[model samples]
Every structure is written in structure tokens, then in C-alpha cells.
Target chain A: MELTRRDAVAALAAVGATGGVAVGVRRMQDREGGEDAATDGASAGDPSDRDTNEGTVRATMVAVAEVVYPGEVDGIDEFVDRFLDGRLDGSAHASGLREAVGELADASQAWHDAPVEELPAAEREELLRGIGADTADEDPDGTTAERVRYYVVNDLLLALYASPTGGELVGIENPQGHPGGAESYQRGPP
Target chain B: MSGAESVGDGRSGGDGTTGDDVDRTPVPNADVCVVGAGPAGALVADRLAADREVVVLDAGPRFDPDDRLARRERAIRPAYDRPDVWDVGGERDAHENAGEWFYPLNHARVKGIGGSTLHWQGMVMRLHEDDFNSGTVRGVGPDWPIDYADLRPYYAEAERELGVAGGSGVDNPHAPPREEPHPMPAFEPSYSDSLFAEACEELGIDIHSVPNARNSEPYDDRSPCVGYGTCQPVCPSGAKYDATVHVDRAEAAGATVIDRAPVQYLDHDADRVTAAVYATPDGGEHRQEADAFVVAAGGVETPRLLLLSESEAYPDGLANSSGAVGRFFMDHLFAGAGGTLDEPTRQNHVGFYTSACDEFYDDADEERAPFKLEFFNYAGPSPVEMALSGDDWGDPLLERLRDGYGNHVAMGGLVEQLPRADSRITLDDDRVDDRGNPVPRIEWTVDDRALSTIERANEVQVAILEELGAEVEWVAGPDATGPAYHHMGTTRMSDDPAEGVVDPDCRTHDLENCWIASSSVFPTSGAMNPTLTIAALALRVGDGVDAWL
Candidate 1:
């Protein structure tokens, strides 16, 4: 599917929040060469070349997105796929995210007898809260709950609010990295 | 000095030489060679290329204007993996810090064709009349060799050249006297600025339109600000003035601009500069001989260049007869207060500031230094920053953004820092750059007086935020504040040859033909943005070089 401005802004927001994801979003946006320019890591190579476990991380993140994202949000699977493409470079941040997703998968397997992606929406929410991710402070190197919150839950919210559609939901029609132009800023929110 | 008739003997005037006309043709000898393609050098070269054979050398690459949007996007990406968008860091830009506070030399400077203007916020202000006589009136710093009247005409000319947008004297009453209105109409205050204005009015403090080099309308063949809302690090639209505009003008005027050409040192004699020996990207060194030279390499590199040019005849350095080449360094320190209110301030909607308060600038006391207060339109955090930094998620996260995203306001102040002899830029022989030259070792000192000034400014800022019923989350003092990167006073101007490096005409006191056109020649730090003054002095240097030729 063609990358839209909304998708580009979401990709940039998600990359910033996750630290090492959505490297190909700028390239996809550049093929159109319109107003939007992603510019996260145009030099980064194939994301699969760096790490082998991006599948579990991407799957876990998608499952978490369904739990943490508001019900009004749509296209969960495609959005997660687009945001995760070229994000998993062989960086420490990418490894931490993978490890965090692994921890969540481990918890799901221990109690629900399946990976997080296989669990139903209600069970996924319960598993996240049962691991204390709903209450723990967001930290990359802290408890399993904190890592889950830091890498998965916050990343989804950031990608949402950073996108044009999500920003408009909270009166930020143009998020910080997008060029909504001078008129967007000159007037107050309608 | 020979007259203009005797200059440019072999070269044709305005031959349409451009920066792209770069080859290994070994730089042609010129009547004037300007080192550093920054605002100072660009203006000087543009002016002198009208009559003299001028050649400009810049250490950094001439960035493609079309790629600025991409650069801005790179800057907008996550701070952790964001590349050096401007290519500012590396062994070539490395330095050492030798003081209580680490001086962010490389972070603060851009060693490219447009220099720091490529990343500057474009706020332009003329120094107040009292700023010139600080020592005589306030007993704070040395009085400048020339006063406001001497630079008044040049300031007007620089404003016209840069296409400044400013409010009328009545709108900005505290500004220095001006003979002409700004070239363009002033930008209206941002929505956040209006919120601060109300609180400032209640506190009996007046805020006025800030003069900026960014275009208000289509001026100088450039588009007006599209507000890409990223003025600090990058202005995707060429709406904001950078030195490249003048560099292009200089090129069109037949001045040869050689980018990626870092001038190592000058080949000088007893009373004149003979040539500027520079390095190419391919690690090739060539000497561009000239009758006159202008060193406009900002504050840090200017002194670093001088100190690197030490020889037997002038063992201290080329222009260090007074032993003051790198002494008396100065920078403006910042103070700020930010908080959240119940109502929306609409912060971050506009990136550049449109209003400021200079009422406290000329009202310095014994304990408190002069300061200028700036109202930040991009206060607090962006929705993305707020989302990522917060601990909440799901519907609660959306609710939190609804409550927190727009209710932020902030005030920042630039407090005057008195020039201290100990706060200087020296060379560390132990460390070297990529070219195997000693790196600049900076010793920055924030004295108790400057700290007291910050405390006083913070009090004013806090009062304004409080007047607006803000929570007053933080107040910046010595511990939280840092330099504004307005580097000045390194090679201060003085009429006496023994007191300073440059004379009233900005010519080196020791070398008659060598001139400095950067903010390095400022005698005092006035808490005003220094680019306009730098442009004025550079124009004056252009005039002086024309007269010398």
C-alpha cells in the first residue's frame, strides 16, 4: 500500500518512541516525493539482516497495540506492520525491545498456554495488567512490567499521537516533526 | 595603501564566478581574501566584490538548499539515533573543555558554508546605546573603542541587507535608536505570546515585537516563512535569512567561494597578511595570496586560527602583540521559567518567537546585570514528546494529552556575562584536530555576579508565569542554565594597541591589513542577539578593506 502523510507522521513518531524502528518509512515516503519526508535512517540496511527475532517483537507489539490503543483506532494489523518494517536494526534498543516482547510471551505461555498474539483481546489486556505493565513506571532496563510499558504500550500511544489523525483527536492537528506549514501554527485550534 | 584603481589587475570584474566553479585551479590571487563563509564573511565578500577581486574560503560543505527539508526531518527523528544532520561532529570539529562547566564548542558551532546561521533562530537585535559605555556607566566591562553612533549607519545598512522585520520604535520602545524603520513589517505575536502579554501587562512589564532576520513577506528573492515550525535547527523554507543568501550574492558579484576549504593559518609579515593558507577536502593545501584579509571565522575558530599562526617574529601569535588574542572570552548565559496552566497556551504551534521584553536590558544594577527576556512559543513538550515521556497509555494517555498538551507556557532570559580574563580559549598542545593542529581548550567561568543576575532574571520570569496562574514547574539558575552560544569578546576592540587585538576599524592592531569581522571584536556582552552587530561590523570591515585597497 502507498504510504500516506498520516502513515509517514505515524512512522516518524513510532521511530522516535521506539528508538530503532520504521527505517523504511522515509524511503517509502520519498518514492512519492511530496511534502512529507521521513528521514529516520535512510542509510540503514534490511531490518531482517540485523536481528532474527523481529517477528516475535512485531507480533507482541501488535497484540499489545490492540490492548493499549483506544477503541476508536482502526487498522491495527497493517499499522503495526508498517510501523515495524525496517525498525529492528541490530542496535541495543532493538534487542531490549525484543527481550521485552520475549518476557511478555514467556508470561503468556506460563499462564495462558500460548504466545501473546494467540490470546484473545480480553485475555491480552489481563495478561498485561497481571504483569503490572499497567501500573509500572516505564523503564527500558527495569522490571518486566516496566520494559513492556516502555517498549510496547508507550510506543503505540506515541505512534498514535504523533500521527496527524491521532494528533487531531487531542487537538494537535500537526505534531512536532511534520511540516503542517505556517498557517497551521499561526491560528488557534478550531 | 593602493587605491581601488590599482587593485584587481588581471581579473575581470563580476565574471559570474560561482561556488560550483570549484576545480584544482589553485585559488586565484585576489585583492581581498575572506576566510569563513559565515554571515560576516558573506556580507564582506558581497560588498567588496563590487570593486575588489575577492575570494571566500569556508571549512564546511555548501549544503543543498533543496535538502533542508530532509535535514529537518532527520533532526526531528528520535534524539538517540538522529544523525548529525548538519555534519557538525567529528575529529575535525573536536575540542577540549578546561573549566568548571564543559563548553559545548562543537555542539554550539556549525563549520559549514553558511556557518551557525544555518541553525540560528534568526532573532536579530542592535546593541543598546548604553551597551557601548558599560564600563564607564555601569563599571562592569571595558568601554568599546567606538560607540553606538559609529555603528548606527552600518546597523541600518545591515538591517536592509539582511531584510529585517521589526515593529516600529513605538511598538518596541526599549530598542536602540534607529534612523530607519525595518525593511519589512514585523511578524505578529504568536498565540502563546498573547497569553504572556496579558500576564506581563498585569505585572507592569512590557513585551514587544522581536526583530528577526526571517522574512515577514517575500523579500530578497526568498519566500516568506512557511513556519515549518522548525526554526531553531532547520528552516526548511529559505524564508529565514542564512549566510548562504549573501554567499550566493557574493558569488553572483564575481567573488569565488571555495567550500570545504579550511584555512589553516595566515602567511603574514610585519604589518600585513600576505596570504591565507587553506586546506581542501582532498587534503591539499594552497596559499591564496591577497593584499587584504578578513578573518570572519566566528569567535572560537577566529582566535584558534590566530593562536595557530604563531611565528618567531610574533611568537605569541600573528596578532598577539598585546597578548590578548584569546583572552577576555564572553558568552550570554540563559535563565528560564516554564509551567503549565489550566487553560490552553497553544505552545509549539509556532516555532520561532515573535515577542520579547528588553525593558530590563538598560536597567542593570550593581548586583544584577542587564538581561533580555524572550517568550517561547514552543514551550513545554510536543504531543509526541509528552506521550513518549509520560507513563500512561490507552484511553488514559489520550485524556492526559487532552489535559496537558496545550496548557504550557515559558519565559527565557539572556543575562549579560561580564568578560573575565580567566574565561578564555587557549590551545591544548596535547590534543589535536584531524589536521594535526592543537585543539582549542576553552575555560568558561560563570561568576557569582552572573549567577546573581540569573537568579534575578529567574525571579522576574517566575513572577510572570505565576501571574498567569502557572504551576512554575522549574526555574533555571546557575545549575540548570548554559551558554546561549552567542560567542563574543574573544578579540575585543580597543583604540589602544596594548589593550585589545582589533582597533576601532576592526583591523588587527599589529597587522594593518588583517581585519576581524566577527562578534569576536565586541568589547562587552550586552545580552542582545549578536548577529546584527556582527553583520554591521562586517560591513564596516568591507568598507575599511575597500578604503585600504
Candidate 2:
């Protein structure tokens, strides 16, 4: 039961599985298939039932997050979900993740008609890059991409690889447990 | 004011009663009480919690890390302008010398759970060997009664607790040898860091990975750093080390942390600090009794607490017999010098600036004035902040932002400030906080040593920039004077009570049961960031208190 750094890493990997669940949930919601959406959903039209010409742009943000950083901890998905739900409140920056995801969805819809899964890796990367470039151009005033690139890239990587598993991925020891060997605090001269 | 009658001065006692009308509210008691959830008090409380009944009080409310990060993007919003909301420091009155814009010196000290470490940059550097025995070696500053060696083990413990990211192979002669490698690899150097490294190498100065408390890879349950520029604000991913991590650990071990309670003064019996009188946010007065008391209200409020606790036992202030409670204040004097590089130097890499030079760390060449100069490796100010400060502004700002969003590298110096008795913190007569306590009056003036150090650091920094074919712009002299949030060394620790406010164990000279935990107990304020050392010292003090209890 001793929690080594490796165990911590394993925990993080486990957390990432939740991202897949989030992606599935979003897909279902987009199809208007759930009872929860019937009363409070943004749209009432069923995309699958009609040729509505609305071109459903289903972005697998979880996959995108994973591609940005592979082999992240399991809890990452949970963290992201909580952040999107405004549950992980700390500072004002946490909301950026949700906002960024919304922008990514909007940008993805504008670029392609196919599901994110059907798009080639290059195409997906191009879509992301365009979004990033556009966001960078508009910066603080960016309507769809406001702080999305910074938040998505940073949060995904941090969730998956920034934890103990990430250290293992790079062959670095988790210094928190072994204080004497590697945890020397450094400061400037007095 | 004579008969303890209502002065109607708006300053109420703990019980929401004006004047000295002994409040009727039930007072809480503990074996030991500590004020402020910052590194100093938290470490002390963490150490004492095992054996003694400990209570820690903080003025700020609990911080939900998620909420904090979510709101961080609104930093420039009006909601961010509230006083005492964030730990950002600035004088109330706008002085002419105060820059045109309010240079936010956000100390990142949080109110709720972890204190300021919640938003810390996580750069954890140890004090150099010279830092401990500066007075003995150079005869310029007072020597710390406890040397670097005395705190080595604790530093190691602190590192473990913080989950620092660094390599053990790097030979830092001043730091104690480590048996294990870093928990995580050093963060990859940013493009600017690499350029600075090359420039330093060209200048014959050593550069290496800067040690940080952030998880490069995951250790513990925390995630790894993702190179987000939010290091100064809040880390939503929980990769950054914050005091809340320890607070959580301590709570798991059965420690109680009370938030939204600000200690007004120390309640004493004769020479001993018996309890702390505090005012709750709801305007209720409560007294908490304890066997021991620790004041970690930071340098400003710690001294302010002592001065306000004017009982008949020690009228000049508790533990102020040496008259050193608020004297010898020191902060790392920082200055930035920028130069355009010949090549891009990969200054846009996610995390590249990790190396540093100690050529001027302690050079007694007289020309250098025995100071340390650290090459800042972290990302500089945002493009907007930089545009405002840089030569480019307005239309030029837009052009520069387009041309060099990720193409500029600048090196800054975290210079040492010589400790002087005159650079002290007293009570501000005109100002009072929400708690009715006098605001900390910081009267500081840079001495020749600091000026000389800055001058020499600028010279070397400019030289390195020039050697790298960079166009250099140095900000020094009167124009460069600005307060760094890394404040330290007001109530220093020493063996002799006459020379310092606290003993080697951080015990106050006058109050047997009172202790201090903060950088305020540092005798010598090293040139580097003090958080790591402060945490380490707190761990050491925690160990001491554990034994004592």
C-alpha cells in the first residue's frame, strides 16, 4: 500500500481513462439522445434523424488532449471534466479550459464536416494549428479561442505527463519521498 | 482613551465590542497556536501538531485550487483590484516614484489552505554557503547562528515534501550532496533560457538547470508541470507544490486549520504567551489559548503582531528586548537588463532558461561588492507588460508583438541586499487594515553594497549580452528600484538574544512558549528566492518542536 512515485504515476494514468468517457458523453449529447438535454439543451433538433445540413462537427477533445500528451495519468480526464463543469475552482484561470474547448469545437466545426476521429492526424493538427494561430492573433480579445491553446496544451500535458508517471516516462525519480538525496532547496547568496 | 471607554475610533476588540469591555464569546484554547498559514507558521504548526494540540489561523478564506485557476485569466479585471484579496504589495498612496502603472508585486500568498505557495513559481534554490556565515567570512552582515550544514537534512526533507525537480549530478559546491537523483528531470529550457545559457557560457560563467519545486514528472499524487505561463497565478493541474499539499497531509494526520480568522494580538500571562486574541470575519472576538504560540504572519504582520501586543510584561513589545523584531529587513533587489541576440537562440522553447552563474556570487574583487547574480530563466513578463516597459509602446508595441512574440531573450539579476538596521518595518500611523491593526510601515533605503552589486551585475550581464552580439538595455540606479515579493530577514534567528529576536531554534528571547516560522527569522537574506529555504527551515523547526512537545 506504500505509495511510491510509480504508484502515483499509475494513478495519473488511471485518471486519463475518464477523458474517453467525457468524449463519449459529449458525442451522445451532440446527438440529442439523452433525457437530460430534452429540457435544458441548447438545440432540440436531432442531427441523425434529418439531413438538417447543419454538418455536425463532433470533436473528440479527449483524443486531442491525448494526442497533445500521450500516456497522461487517469485522473486527468476527471480534472478536465471538473474544470469544464466549474467544479475545480481555485483561481480564474481554471475556466479557461472550458472556454478553450468551446472555441476548439467551434473552430473544428468551421473547418471540416467529418467527425474528429475520421480526420487524419495531419488534418487534425492543421485544424489545431489554425486555431492556435488565430487565437494568438486575437489574444486577449479572441472570441472563440481566448486562452484555449495555452490552457488545453498546458492542462493536457500537465495532467498526463506532469505527474509521477511523467517523471517515470522521462526516467526521473519522484523527489518528494527521498528528501535527503535529491530535495535540496537552493537560494541565492545572503 | 483613558478609562478603556469607547473611543469610537472604529477599532473594535475581539468581541465586536469597542474599548476594553471583556467580550462574552467563548474563547477557544489549544496546546499551541500559530498565526498565518504561510510557510513559517505552517511548518511550525506541522511540527508541533504531532505532540501538541495545535491550531493555525489565517485571515484569508480557504482556496479551492480549481476556482483559483478558473479566475486567474481575469487578473486585469476589477474584481482583482480588491485590497487584502490577493497578496500583491503596493503602497496605498501613489508616490511620484511609483511607476506610471501599478507594477503588481503579487506575493502569491493565498488566504485559505496553503498560503502563498499555492501560486508560487516553485523555484526552490538553497542559500549559498556564504549566506549562512556571511558576517564571519566577509564581516559585512550578521552571521546566522546556525550555518548551512545545520539545516542540510531539513532542506532535503523539504525538497522531498515539495517534490522538487532537478538533477543530482550537477555540482553545486555550496549545497549539500544528495544521494538520490532528482525526482523528475529538470524542466526543458525555454528558448530564452537557452540563449541566456549560451550567452553566459560565452562570458565564461557556469550555467545549469535551475532547481524547482514543481513536479517535472509526477511524484506523489500531483501531476507534472505543463509549461503553462500560469506559474505565477494558479496551477489548475495541481502539478505545482503548494502549502495546501502539506496542510492536507497534516489534516490527514489530525491537524485542524481554521480559516477566515485574523489574530489581533497575543494574549499573555506574565512573560508567557498564553493565547491569541483574534477577530473573525463576522465581527466576533475569540481567544485561543495554547501552550506555545508561533507567529508567522510574514515579515510585515509578524512584527506588527509583536508591537501590537503591548502588555505590561514587555511594553516595548513581546520578544523585542533586542529591539530587532522589525529591523534588518531585506529583499532580493532585482533588476532586468535586456539585449537583442544575434540569433533567435530558441528563446521560445516551452521551458529553456535553467542555468545560472555565480561568478559574482561572492567575488570580493571590491569591484563586484560580494553579491550573487542569478540569470532569470523563467518566462519574462507577458507581451503586453513587456511592450509597456520595453522601448516599444503604442503602435511600435503592436509591431514588436507581431515580430517577436517568442523571439526575445532577456537576463535579469536577483541581487542581494545588505542587511541594515535602518531598513526596518514599523507601524504606519495613517493606515490600518480591516483588523484595525496598524499597517506595516516599511521604511527602506538601498545602501552602497546593494547599489554596487547592481552596478557590477549590470556590467557583467551587459557584457554577456554584448558578447552574444545582443543590443543591451540595463535598468539599474534610482530608476531600477522596485520591491521584489521575496521579502525576508526582519526578525532574524541567532544564538544570542541580544543580536536577534529568535534563538537558533526560532524561539523568541522573551517569550518562552512563543516561536517564529518565516523568512523573517533569517539573519542573512540570500540573493536567491527564499521560499525553498523558508520551507526547509520550517521543516527543521517542525522537527525541533516535535521533540520539544
Candidate 3:
């Protein structure tokens, strides 16, 4: 249960992530947890009332993906980034996501003295559970915990199981959309 | 009327050409002009194109077969959001629900060249012998003018044409008599079907391989099913048969197919249709004159067209002297039962149903209607969708998915609804589609007899689930059931001209040269899927039209 940068990499390897995908995951993780952005949370104006932009949303989502995705899941950051690339269009869904992530960031800053992305992985998990996101019914226009469950936690899990690598870890080589061909379906699991 | 202006909303064609870029050249006169490029029109056009000049006019665009992968992706990523993945929406596909029970007409149909077959589940079942002799056998619905004996050869030919895959003739206990086996070998049942078969064996219910138009092996130069599991919305692989195959064949055999040309109305004299007036994407209208005319515009649209073509000669509507243009609208209601099993059923791995029980199909009487019970292969929660919608995350989410995803099982039934005079499609006076044509008003009603039949079906489904030691979560009775979208019985067929729209040959009773090739000519809504029967009847109509010419 030890949370480290190596743990994330090992998780990616466990799901048989390709080297290219593993590298992409590392790049996304570095972009979020770089020294400059880590200090920006502390140096910025009132963290609880900070501006909620696409950068904050992406960083918060990456942090959330680390907690929600299974330990066996590979390439969490890159997979999430790619999934969010299509989802975070300037639609109402994107706006709701930004608002929800901002709420989580505000709570982390007010209670734990740091942004959600700046907090340790255990504290981030503790913060999410403390706000009742673990048991809240997902609602876009409801409580802060409900919105976090809807946009952040569920979104990460959706991206994981829907991905080919993560789906194979659960013995679903071909999920709903991916074509596994007739032979794959006709034969029982090995 | 229903044909012309309603389909000219400037949508892009399947081949990536916009409607505005369509060739506006006047189509030359033809030996036969077929409206609606669905299975019915495609078959008739393909049949007649060899020796005669055939022109097919469709209200929708032709879809490119190559673009199915992208369409499949859309079905997967936003699975819940986009039910109509074929771009079947907007004002062009609008309608009014006049019935107490809201009938989702637009959701049920696609106006493209392949018609609803573009997204149909590909289950092709022939009507039982009792289905043809319903009135004489059970005194419920009217008897079909032509019996199963008359359609036997055509059904065989249609099976060959559509490349149906099924078990031997001896497999199904209630199967109608057929000479040859299915064209291709049958697809094996899903893992879940084996579990259901165990329970059905105890209850004396017979389970047989479902006859489907999808390929088990490569046939007719199309790929076999690749198991995308998005068969309902989009079949990324061309394994499932759609009407586009016949449409392409018709074109290859020298038929002139005009996509995105919605017919306004037919120009006719007292006895025969002379020309079909259709609209282009531009505000221009042109008439395609022909020696004969065939309307294959499906149940809802075909009736709407006839009703829209009201004139002085035929005051009721064109070829509607019998006043039976849209009198007997019918559809099959779906009855379902599902629950959680302790063992893994491994559901949702395969998309389409592979096993069915037709034992109750011949049991129609005054008490209960005929029905086909299907073992659903795609029942239960999808791992991704279920995990995302839950209130848990991380390891707890994985635990919930492991416990919930593979242990779900369900069974579905297609219960037949008898034809009622009031359950009909009429043109709405107030509401109009995008083209300013009066939309088709669907007035559907389920009587006590149909409700009782649904209850009977639910009982059987629930019994099977109980036998499997399932938790018995939900049962869909009459109130919870909805239509399976097998539109039939409108513009029904009758031997006597006074009682029906088309005669035995599917020719209009009043018009000398007008014919209908769609399932709209069906007299009864059989408990089976209607595509095979539609194909057989369409081919019969083609031969009849050819001989008449």
C-alpha cells in the first residue's frame, strides 16, 4: 500500500503497458507533479479561492486517477489524459468537471494546507473519503462530494475499464467498443 | 406527402457526398420506379434490374460501409447518450405520438438507403404456419391471403439471398417446414445460453439456435462477425446483413438509385400511378415516370404516403378505395425478466442473441397470444458502465464490478399483438416534419389479450431465471414492456379488395400498376421477426410486377 512514483510505474507494468504508453504516462505525471507547479499551489493567492482553469482541472484529475484506478491498471495518467482530451470540450460537461475539481482542490487547501495535486497520495485519498465522495451518488448540480464522485472518481474508473489494457486485466480483452473478432468470443476464457 | 419533401433536409450521403451536391439531372423514364431503398425496395429493384430499367428513389442517404468503424466507436464511447448512432434525428425524422402509450417512431426507424436494417439485430425468423391461418386457426387476427405454402420457395430464396445462419431444420421444435437447411452453418450459443439451456431442459422448453442474417463464416464475400458487441447501434464489421447489399446489387445490375430524393406524391389517374414526384436537396421537384410503381416505404411511411396523396379521383387517398391504407397498425411488445446469478454467466461479451425458444409460438388462442422467448446474450451491466455509475471507487469499485458484472442473466420475449382497427397510422393535421409535410400520427393500443400474453411470457422468463437460482430482480410485464419495432399490419393484405390495401400479389386493390413491397402488406403481426417475410414478399412482388409488365 506504499504510494510512490515507482508504484505508479509498476502498476502500469503489471497491466502489460507498452514502453511508449509507459513513457507517455511518465510525461503526464511529471507535467502535473513538476517542482514549478508543486510550488505554485503554495506561492499563489489564497489556495481555497484560487481560479479554476483547465490546468487545475487536469492536475486534479491526474491526482484523482492515481487513487481511483486499480493497482493493476497501467498508464493511468496518459489514459486519463487521452480520455479527457475528447471529454473536456467547451460544453456543459467540461464546465461541470472544472467546478467539481475546483471544489476538491479548495477543500484540500483549506483542510490539508495544500492543493489536491500537491498533497501526498494517502492524504488525497483521505481527503476524498472524508468529504463523503466514496459513498455519494454522482450529481452534477448537487453537493461538492457528489460532483467529485460524478466527474473525478467515476470518470477515472470509466477511462480505466474502457481502455484495452485495463479491460484485459479484468479478463475483458474486448470491451463493448473494441472488436475482438468472432474467434475471441466463440472460445471461452483461457 | 411522406416521401418527397420530408427526406430532402440536405444531409450528407453515406458515400460522403452532401445532398446539395447530388446530381440534379432529370432521371430518365424507367420500367419500374421503386420508392424507399430498404430491404423491400432493394430486393424488388435487384430482381427487376436484370431485364428492365429500374429506378430506386430513397428519402434518406446511402451510408458508406467503410465508415462503420467510426460509427461503432461513437456507439461505444458515449454508449448511453447516442442511441440513434446512424444520425436518425432532427426535424427530418420527427413525428407525433397520438396514442396513450407513447410510441417512439423516430427511435424505431432509420430513413437511410439500408432503412432500419442498418441497425437491426439481424434475427430473421419465418412466420409460423399458424401465423398465416390466424383467423381460420384461432379466430384472432385476419388470415394472410397467401399461406406459408405459397411463400415457402420465396422464403428459401430469401434465406439464400440474405445468407442466414442457423441450425438444421430439425433443431427448432416449432419451426415452420423448410426444404433446405440455413444457407450457412449456425453460430454457436454464448456461454450464458448454456446456463439457460440447463434450466429450459428441466421445464420442457426447447432452445434452438436463433436464425440470423449475420454470418457464422464468410458468405457472399462479407466478413464474419468480429464481435464488436455494438450490433444494435452499429455493426463495425459487415458481418450482419443490411439491405445495402441488395441495394448495391440492384445498382450493379443497372438500376438507377437516387439517394436523398424524398417523394412528395404520386401523379395518378383513376386506375394507375403514372409518375412519382420527388424533391431534391435544392427546392426543385422532378417527376420520374415509369410503367409500374412500387412503394416499399415501410409500415408508417407507406401508409402516410397513401393518406397524403388524397385527390378527387380517390377521395380517401391514392389506391385507398378500400379505406385500408393504415387501418391495422401492429408491432411486437417485448417482455423481459432478469436477475443476478451466483455463478458467472459472462454476459455482454457477445452482443446478439444466439438462442431462442419458439415452443409457445403455436399456442395462440383466445387466452394468450403467440410469443418467442429469447435468451439474451447481452444482458446485465457492462463492466465499464457499471463501475462508473456506482457510488464506490478504487479497490471497492473493482470488488463491486467483480461481484456484479459477470453474475447477471436475463431472458427476453417478443409477444405478438393482434391487429386492432384503431391501432393505425394517420397523417397529423397540425404537426409537420422539417419538409413541411404532415407527420405520421401513430395511435397504438394494447388490449387485454396482448397484456395477458405479455404476462404469460414474463412468467416463463421468470420461471427460467428462478431455476437458475437467480435473485429475481425485475420482471417486465405488460406495463413495463415496449415495442420491438417490428412495424407490420398497416396497409394489410386481404384477398377481398374491400377489406385490405393490397391483394395477394401486394398490388394495390384500386390501382392497376401500383404495388407495395414492405411488411405494411402483412395481415398479421407474427411473433417472429418480419425481415425474412418482408424479403420473401418483396421478391414475390418483384416477380408479380415483372410478369404483369
- TM-score of every candidate's chain A: 0.74, 0.48, 0.69
Residue-wise C-alpha lDDT for candidate 3, range A1-190, written one tens digit per residue? 2233433322222222213432343456458875434222222343331347556777889988888877765565665554554444323445566668888988998999999988898999999998888888766557888778867776566556655555565566556655556655554556
lDDT of 3 by residue, B44-75 (tens): 99999999999999888776654564455344
For every model in order, what is the iRMS? 13.8, 17.1, 9.8
The predicted structure with the larger TM-score, 1 or 2, is 1
- What C-alpha lDDT, on a 0 to 100 scale, does residue B514 get in candidate 1? 95
What's each prediction's TM-score?
A: 0.81, 0.69, 0.82
Docking class of 2: incorrect
Please tell me how candidate 1 rates in CAPRI terms. Answer: incorrect
- By summed lDDT, the worst window of 10 consecutive residues in model 2 chain B runs over B1-10
Cα lDDT, model 1, residue B507: 97
Candidate 1 local lDDT, B141-240, one digit each (tens): 8899899999999999999999899995669889999878999989888777878889999999999999989898999998887655668777766889
CA-based DockQ, model 1: 0.19
